[model samples]
Structure formats: structure tokens, C-alpha cells
Target: MTSLTVDRPTTFDVHSPATGTVVGTYPSHDELAVEAAVDRAHGAATWWRTAGFAERARRLDRWRAEITRGRDELADLVHAEMGKPRSDAKLEIVMALEHLKWAARHAEKVLGPRSVTPSLLTLNHACRVEYRPFGVVGVIGPWNYPVFTPLSSISFALAAGNTVVFKPSEYSTGVGVWLADAFARAVPEHPVLQVVTGGGDTGAALCRSRVGKIGFTGSTETGKRVLAACAQRLTPVLMECGGKDALIVDADADLRAAADAALWGGMSNAGQTCLGVERVYVHTDVYDAFLTELLDQTRELRAGSGDAKIGPITMPKQLEVIRRHIDDAIARGGRALLGGLDAIEGQFVQPTILVDVPEDSAAVTEETFGPTLVVTRVATMDEAVERVNDSDYGLGATVFARRHGQAIADRIESGGTSINAFVAHATIPTLPLGGVGASGFGRVHGPDGLREFTYAKATTRQRFPSPLALTTFTRSAAIDSAVDRLVSVLHGRIG
Candidate 1:
């Protein structure tokens, strides 16, 4: 509802990728400033943790309402800062609101104390497990889908009763400030959410400041550094590194649907999505049909400054990566089905599609992080699944078979999958979103996300005295023998 004006001697200018004009300026937060923000968040966490889920949920719901009310202002900032279409920016905000609502509504149910079926050996004890807030959570977010990505961790952390200090990418600091500003309005008494604007040094400061946990969303290479830095304090971390996701089209799949989903998944937001579809594996039986339909859909889309289906690449430097991957694919026996190397003139990279790219080419192997898709024909779904699984990154996958979508998706080595569509899995709050291997670890939605920012505390209380107790030092040797006999009676068959 309001803008947060952060003051510091040092500042960084945010330039619009679409116009190459200065859009906004943000404080270049130093290590001390970052520490101060975390210190404030630490104090806030204590009060928030004791606020109980009911109170916290009320505040969260209020914040969500404010976000919905301020959608246009926030969406304009998102478009100016990240170069995403205003509509797409609003979608991100809506998705974030849904996630926030889900988190607030589910916190008590997901994190509260619950009776656990304790081991039979400890039947005399009443055992229960509960999740506790980790005091403070540090979030290092990405520029693409800034609102949705950062809040994926922030909302869940807050719902779990942890105060959060978020450092959004240098590009989207305004959006972060707006979100925190709205939060301040919702809960005026405590600084439950804070934002620090800066680059790498400030992020490192947050990691070393001993925040209870760190949630980072960025590149895998950078994620490794975040993980290593957190090891200084043994601080727990959850990483949502970008992924080189693929869309697989089985022989029986609806080719039109596959092409439609692939185009939207790969080209939306100018293909700046972490789980953006980078590769396509179509069964040979339908490979030609799928490719034809994909190109047809792509032809209807364009990347530009106006109301185009896509927008410019938010990160200017990524243009080089996009060009490299396209060049590598074309130079190494791949044919450009649609736009190719020349399509990228300025900040905008027109939708580019390649066919027959070598499996080892950078276009297929590495994360292009651009609006480009590499299509490869495969002999069968088996080959498609194997090729998709061979990548080091496993963030998300899409299977387009109506009949066998679930079966084929089950074999893909990714955190989540969408049947007949891509990117839809992200809207489901109950499905945990994260990646395997190089795509990074830890989740940011669902129950797994609620637990990501908390610590599990297990407790046991004596419900009744056991006939033969083993935990007591006062127990006799005959009692120990009796315990052994009980164990033997319960487990002798296994040994």
C-alpha cells in the first residue's frame, strides 16, 4: 500500500531493460545494515513465534488483502523492473496471494503438536511432535517472478511463526519493499518482515549473521556458495535453484496441447522462468506433428516493448548466455525451426526453437534461462524419459500423454510434473516445489515448505509406569533381560 524508502550513503540505480532508462534507485546495503535488519527481525521473531497460529494467520490474511488491493501499483513496478508483461506480473502476484492464503490457513494444521505413533518399546510414554519457529529466516530471492519466488519462502516462514529478512535481487528491490511495506501496515507493532536492498555482499552478510535458516532462489553455482557460507554458523538452508525443465510428448499425446503448453511455458516472461521449458522430447511417432504445431503457436507470439505475448529479458547479461546456447545448437548440426541467433537484437529475445540439437550441446545441456526451446525426437517414451533424467538438474518436468501421463511422469527425475501442461504444478499449493541434485534442494510450498523454516521439537511424558522399565538407572539386570525377551518376542522373525 506504500513504498519503503531505505536510506544509505551508497545506492544502486535500477535500469529498465525495455527502455534502458533509469527506473528506480535503491540503497546498496552494507554488511552492517544487513546485520541491523536481521537483528530487528530476530527480535520480531520472538514476539511472532508466541503470537500463535490464529493471530499470525489473521495478520497474514490482512497482508494478502492489501496485496490484492494494491495489485495494479505492484504490477506496474514489476513490469518496469523485470520487463515482464503487466498481465504476467499480476499472475505472479495472484499466485503469491494464493500461496500466502494456503500457508496461513494450513499452519496450525501442519505445524501444531500431533501425537506420533511412538516405538512399541516406549509404550509407557506419550510422544508428540511439534514444529517451532526458527527465530529468523533470511531469504535471498531471484529477479524472475520476484514476488512469487521470494514469498514462496517468506509466507510459509511467517505462517510457521518465523520473522523473515528478504534480500530480493538487485533488479526487483522496489517490489520487495512494497511487499514488506504492506506487511508493516498489516502488523504495525512488530517488524515481522523486512527488506534489505543490495548485491552479493549484503547477501553474504545475511548468511553469516546467524539467521535461523536461509532460503535462496537463484543459480546452482550461486546456491553452492550460499550453502557453503551458511555452514559458518551451521545455519539451515533451503535452495530453489533454477532448472532446465523439459516437456515430453508421448506418441498418444495431444500434439496441439503439448505445443501450446510448451510455447507458454518457455516463452512467457521472455523465458526467464527458473522452471522454464528448455528442451522438448517428442516420440518419433508424433515428433513431426508436435514440432509443426509448436512452431505454429510460436509464430503467433513476439517479444517487444508493447502488449506482446512475451517481454524483454530482465537480466541484460543473460543475453550472452542465450546467444551462446543458440549458436552452439545451430553450429553443432541443429536447425532453427523458428527464430534463431539473429532474433536477439536488443533486450528482447524473440522466441527461438531448435530441432535436432546434439544432446551434449549447451542448448540442451545447460540452463539457457532464455526464451528458447530445443526439440529432440526420440524413439520411444523410454528414450525420452532417460534423456530427460540424464540432466544434472531436476527441478520440474512436463509429460503430455493423456493416457500414460502419470506413469511417464513418475519415471522423470524431477520435483514436480504437469500432465498435458507445464507450469500449472506451481499453482497447486499442496504440491511441494523444489528440485533434485543441481537444481537445488528444499521446498517452498505445501507442508514441506512450512517445515523448511522451522525446527521439530519432540517431547515425551510418562503416561503410565511400565511393568519393566529400561530407561531408569535404578532398573535391575533381570528387568533388562525382560526387555530383551520382549524385543525378541516382537522382532525375532526379522533376524
Candidate 2:
């Protein structure tokens, strides 16, 4: 086991939230080191892509088994680095394994060749589309839900036959290294996956690398910078940026279930999730009842380092942002039914709920990536829907209407929506996961995810000659006139 060290930063500490003691120090990688790793990955990807779908699937299955067998050890590493509860960490690992398995099983069907009908003009030639792997893929991951988010990109990329170079968030670099080690053991013959540990500079280097594509999950502001960096090389990107997602409650909705889902979805991992529910819109008929239930569930959430209901905020800098959101909400006349700005201590921010906050307040319009939520009352379902769609970020949304759940969900302009549940669509394993507008673009789940790392190649084979010859230098004026008449009869109408 060679200790991976670089000339960049020597020692960055990871502190234990439970004890506030330094736990570990990670070595950071420099540009030269990152480029070398990507260079190796490019060669490996060429070989791996040529191995065909069956061989890649077999390798992925073996990797999946290895991950399942060592799930506990891996979960422990995640818990130590990210300060998440052991159970939650285990759940993240399990979901990542599920994604790995799903990608392997479905890649062939999703990315395989398909025949398409040629236009009448080109009927003399046959046409088909085939997906080709991008040589190397670069993944910049987030600390919150570290395993699930990064693997969501990497698994799909690998399944599509691209090698990966991942730069995990600085807070969870150890866990990222562990994942790469596991993959190396499972597929020692090829360096198909590698981890580069560092802060923003390393991420920037990766964006500027010669990789075929870049997938990033982080704040919208940083996502903009990443897009700018990747633009230098004209590289394509799949960015899962920040989201201030909303949950709509109709007049006949179930308040208890909605409250439970909202509380968990908003406060889990200290609300560090990109798709966490940050806003709630409820009809005035059950507004009081819904708010009461939501506060009750929220007050019971305890943040600590052990087997607590919630963990500390993974990044230290986020605490200030959380405090500012609460302060802005309070100054704008929003009533704090639960916790307030002072509730944020160090890395842990107790669950805070604000009501009566103006729509123009920062808490309502901005991405408050913390354990705080804004609740507002609406007179009708249409108003609720309108309010939810007003934000620029449209990552994930929830609808709690029994009769019109699907209809309401379809109306929301978001990447994904759950009917009567929160974050349930993420676990379904068959739907696309991403957002529209400022929430960023591209997808990292299901068939869309499998295709994100590959380019479509259209192949046309000329077979027998057609009755009327075209695409030849010897074509006659008579043939051109006949083609025009045929097209007019087939598609034209006298308007």
C-alpha cells in the first residue's frame, strides 16, 4: 500500500464532531499528479470499452460483491470522515451498491445499438445509432451524501465504458480513497477508477484536464466557476447544482405523513443535501395543523455525533450561511416556531422552521443549504404550485395530494417529483435524477445516466440500389422531379 502523497498541501485535519478532536489528515494532490492519473485512465478506458458489455458487467458484479461483503468497514470510514450516523452511512453505501448493480445490469440495454427509419430521401441507405464511450470521465463530488452522489456519476460512467478520475470533497477524502481502493482490488488488471484528494484547486485542475466529460455536484456558485473552467476546453458537463426544493400540500392532503417526510428530508445530514426540501407551501385550510405537526416533528430532531437524530454540519463554513438565512428570515417578520439563528453552534445547526416569511426574503428565494425550512400558506392548489415553481432552482419537488398527486407532480417544473413522499424517487433506480434552470443540467440515474458518458455514433450501410437513384453523381433531372412529387404526395397538403 503506497501512501499517496503530493507536493501541494501536506496536512489537512478532519475533526470528530462528537469530541471536537482532530481525527485524520489527508494529503492533497497537485495538477501534475492529477494529470498523470487521468492519462493512465485514458489508456485504461480505451481497453475497457473494447472489452464489450458482457465483460464490463462481469467485472462490475464482482466489484458489487466486494462492496457488499465489506459494507460495514466502508460504512465506518464514512461515519468517521463525514460525522454521519453509522446507520445513515450504511444506508448511503447500500444505495450506492444498488446503483452500481443497476448500472451494470441496464447499461447494455440502454446504450446498445438501435436502428432508425431513414427519411424518404435517404431510403436507399440504412441507418443505425450506437453509443461510444468517452475515453475518461472526471467527477467532482460533494461531501454531503459523499458515496451516493459521486458513485451515482461514476457507476453510470463506468457502465457506459468510460474510466473515471474522481475528486471527492475535502471533508470526505478518506472515504473516497477507500472506494477507489475497493475498485482497484476488484479490477486490478486496469486502473479504471482513481481518486485525487484536495480542495477547490484540485477540482479546478480536473475540470481543465483532458477528460471527455466532467460531472460535478456542489453549490450553484461553484458550479458556475466549474462550467467556466470546462468551457476553456469545450468539454461537456453534467452539473447537479444547489436546490431550494419545495413541497406542496393540498387541501385534502395527509398532514402527518407530509410533516414526517418534510422534517426528515429537510434536517437529515443537517440539511447539507443538494435536493433537500427547503420550502413548503400548504393550503390555508390545513395550514395551522400542518405547521403544528411539522414543528412537533422538527423539535424532536437532536443533532450530535453519536446515534442521534441528526449530525453536525459537515463543513464549517456552512454554519455562517445557515445563521444568516435564519437572521434574514426573522428580520423580515417571519415567526420562528421552532429554532432560530442562535441555534447554530459550531458545525451543528438545530432544525429551524420559519413561517410568514416574505417571498422576497433571502430564506425563501436563495439556497439555504442548512437545516432550516420556510413554510408559507396558499389559498388554492394553483397558488401552491405557482409558488413552488417561482424559484430558479428546480431540482426535486414533492406533492402530497391523494387524488391529484400525479397531476400536481407533473405540473411542477422540476427534474423529479415524488407523490406523497420525499426523496422516494431517488431510490426508485429507474428514473432520471437532475434539475432544470439554475439547478444545473444533465442526469445521473436510470437510462439517461447510462447515456451521459457516451457519444452516439450513427452508422449507415448502403445495400441494394433504389428504383430512383440519388446520392450519386449520375442522378438525372427526371429522378429529382420524381422525388419531389413523391415527397409532396406523402407529406404535403393544400393549405
Candidate 3:
């Protein structure tokens, strides 16, 4: 594996958790090299933005074809690097390809020019708004859902005519490199998309680089630091941070369906997903039934290396955090219905289900980022909603209400909520994907994601002159008085 040198002797090793052997070693990039990469990206960005949407779309389409053709190879890389099941790896790649397709197909319509009404003050002028690409975008991706999360930013940015400099999580560097290689084959004329591999310092350097915008997806604490670094250069950023999302089950909910959805959402990818369901609230009347079904469904899950239902935790350090959360819950008088801390052996953390965990416990409040969930009971639907909304992170929520699904979903304080489903809303290409509060700001998956990488430029041209002309220094006080009178007449309220 290729490596970069830093001031200090820093190194990262990728190990096969299933086999307990070193897979690869990568070096940390020094500050100087990072600066050089940013400079190169600047020049490449100018060329990319000049290519226009038509050319860019063609390139993106070709890249999509490349990914589609090599889906198995890419899936294998994902499975080897992140330890997700082969099926799940394939799903991630498919989702990424879907995003690429959506971005290419809709870029022109979503970001094309639109007419805007010129206010009375500028009556003589016609106004139009269009999106202008940011020069270069710096993307810092996470390990969980490596392809899907990073491509969410990368594809949209490219569609919006912005170049991308991606730094994938150290755990998934190989996948990142493969993605860049595919893009290079699609658009060999310019280095519009490039990958920089390293650790935290490398990511920090990207934030401080001259990139026009930064898109980071990771922990909330790390997001804050990234925001601070970007602030130094006044570079805008889109932060997709940690999430402790909840699943709310109403009295009328289908317990079996809800249990199945929650199990897949919480335990898939070993619970490393940012929008993974961490906490579940069920109405007191049906809490026992829901708990029973959830526990039974989760207990059947197996985490291993070979063809299993789920794979081992990719980041070894996360194993300790998952163990800590299980330990804390067990210590706080919570009962582990299925697996516990002891279940976390090596990199495989057995699916865990905890009941009666205190609301104040770390498992409930903090992001476990593991295959464990806490199920709680609430007396009323209102109480369930309140509990789900009480957290600092509001990335996504799930509502399992047969009758009032949409109403309950709308009331939740989250970016996206799935009614009668878990994370199904995110698959819809039209709806935006992001979070509020501690889950961080900005979006990454829909028309909103495409616009995030561009700035709105309003242009005005004089089509015809109106009776009232007020934008020039030649305007008289009499005209201003007439305009004020018209404004008052239109908007004045009765006393």
C-alpha cells in the first residue's frame, strides 16, 4: 500500500478482523503535501466547472456504467475493508449507483435557471436565478456505508460542476481509491475527482485547504472541530454528523413488521450507520409484545466473516465503545434480553437487545455505533414522540402508525422520517437527506444535495421599462414618495 509522510511517525494499519491479520498499512500525509493537493485541485476545479453540465453529465454517466460493470469487485472491496456482509456491500454499491444516476438525470432540471419576480423597487429589471458551482469541494467521509455516504456528496458535487477532493476514513481507504480510479477512467481529461488517504490530520488539512466548501460525515465532536478549522478560511461546510435516531411504535402499529424493520435498521452494517436506529419507543399497551418480537428477531442475527447475516465491526476501536455502552446499560439496572458486553469478542459484536435501560444511560443518549439497541416503553403516543424528540441528535426517525403515520411522522423533529418504514424515505431521490441539531447541518441526498455545492447567482436584465423606475441615482424624491404610498396601500393592515 502507498503511504504519505508526516512530521511525526504516524501509521495506520488495516487488519482483517475475521482472520486477525494485517491487511495493509498507510502513512499520514504531511501538511505540505496536503497544501499541494489542494492547489492542484483548484486548477482541476476550474477545468471541471468549465466543462458545463452536459459534459459533466456524460462523464458521470460513464462513471456510473463503470461502477455497474464492476459491481462485484467493488462489493468485494467494501466487504474486505468494512467487514459488512457481501449482500450489504452490494446494496451499498447499488444505492451509490442509484444516487449517481439520480444526480446525473436531475442536475439540469434542479439547478437550471428560473425566473424570479422583481420587487416593485426594481420594476424595470427582470430577474433570474441560477446555480454556480463552487470551485473545489473537500469531502471527509466515514467508515460506515463508505460508498453511499461519500458518493452522496461526490456525485452531487460533480453534477453541480464542482471538483471533489475526497478523504475516506482510514478503514475504507481502498474503497475510496477504487472509486477515484473509476472516475479517472470516465473523465481522463482532468483530475476532477481525487482521493487523499490518511488519518485525522489529513482530514483537518483538507478542511483548511483552499477548497470552496467542505462536506464532512462523522462524529459530532469531530464535526465541531472540522467546522472550526473551516471557519479559519471562511469556507462553508456541510456537516453530516453522528445520529442517535429513535423508532417510535404506536398502539396501532404492526408489531411484527416494526420488529423486523428495527432489527435491520439497527443491526445491519453492525450498527455503524449514522442513521441506524439506536433507541425504540413503544406504547405501553404493546411494549411487551413489541419487545418480545424484537428480541426474537434480533437473536437470530449472526455476526461473522463468512456468509453470515451480519459482519464484524470494521473499526476495531468501535468494539470497545460498543462494549462500554452494553456495560453501562447492564450496570444501570438494564436487562440484556439477548447479547451483552461478553458477546463482543474481537471485532464481532453479537446483536444485543437491552430492555429497561435508563434514559440517562450512554446507550440511550450517546451514539453507540454498534449492533445494540435499547427498547423503552412509553405510556402514550405523545410520550413516545416526546422521548424520541428529546435527544440532541435528530437525524432521522421511524414511525410505525397505520392510521396516523404521516401525522406522527411530520411531528418528529428530524430531517427525514419514515412512516411505517425504517429508512425507506432516504431511498426516494426527490426528498432531501440530512439532520438537524447535533446531527449537524446541510444535506447530502436529493435536489438539496445538488444545490449544496453551488451558489445561487441572480441576474437581472432590462427587458422593458415600467412606469415606476427607482433603481438609478436619477430617481426623484417624488417617485420615492409614490412608491412608499403604493407599498402602504398594498400591505397596510386595519387597526
Which candidate ranks first by TM-score, i.e. highest?
1
- Per-model TM values vs. the true structure: 0.97, 0.97, 0.95
Off by over 4 Å in 2: 1-9
User: On a 0 to 100 scale, what is the lDDT of residue 293 in model 2?
Assistant: 90
Per-residue alpha-carbon lDDT of model 2 for 1-495, expressed as tens digits?
A: 212555655667776655667767777777887888898898788789988898999989888888888888888877787788889888998889889999999999999999999987678888999899888999999888888999999999999999999998888887788788888888888789988878898899999999999999999999999999999999999999989899999888999999998888888877878888999999999999999898777776878766886888777777778888889889989988888977787778788889999999999999887888899999988898898899899999999988988888989999999999997888877888999999999999899999989999999997768878877899999999999999899889867
Q: Write the per-residue lDDT of candidate 1 for residues 227-269, one digit (tens) a residue.
A: 8999999998898897889999999998888889998888888
lDDT of each: 0.90, 0.87, 0.87
Backbone clash total, candidate 3: 0
What's each prediction's clash count? 0, 0, 0
Q: What would the TM-score be for candidate 2 when compared with the true structure?
A: 0.97
Q: Candidate 3, residue 345: CA error in Å? A: 1.3
Name the lDDT value of residue 79 in candidate 2: 79
- Which is superior by TM-score, 1 or 2? 1
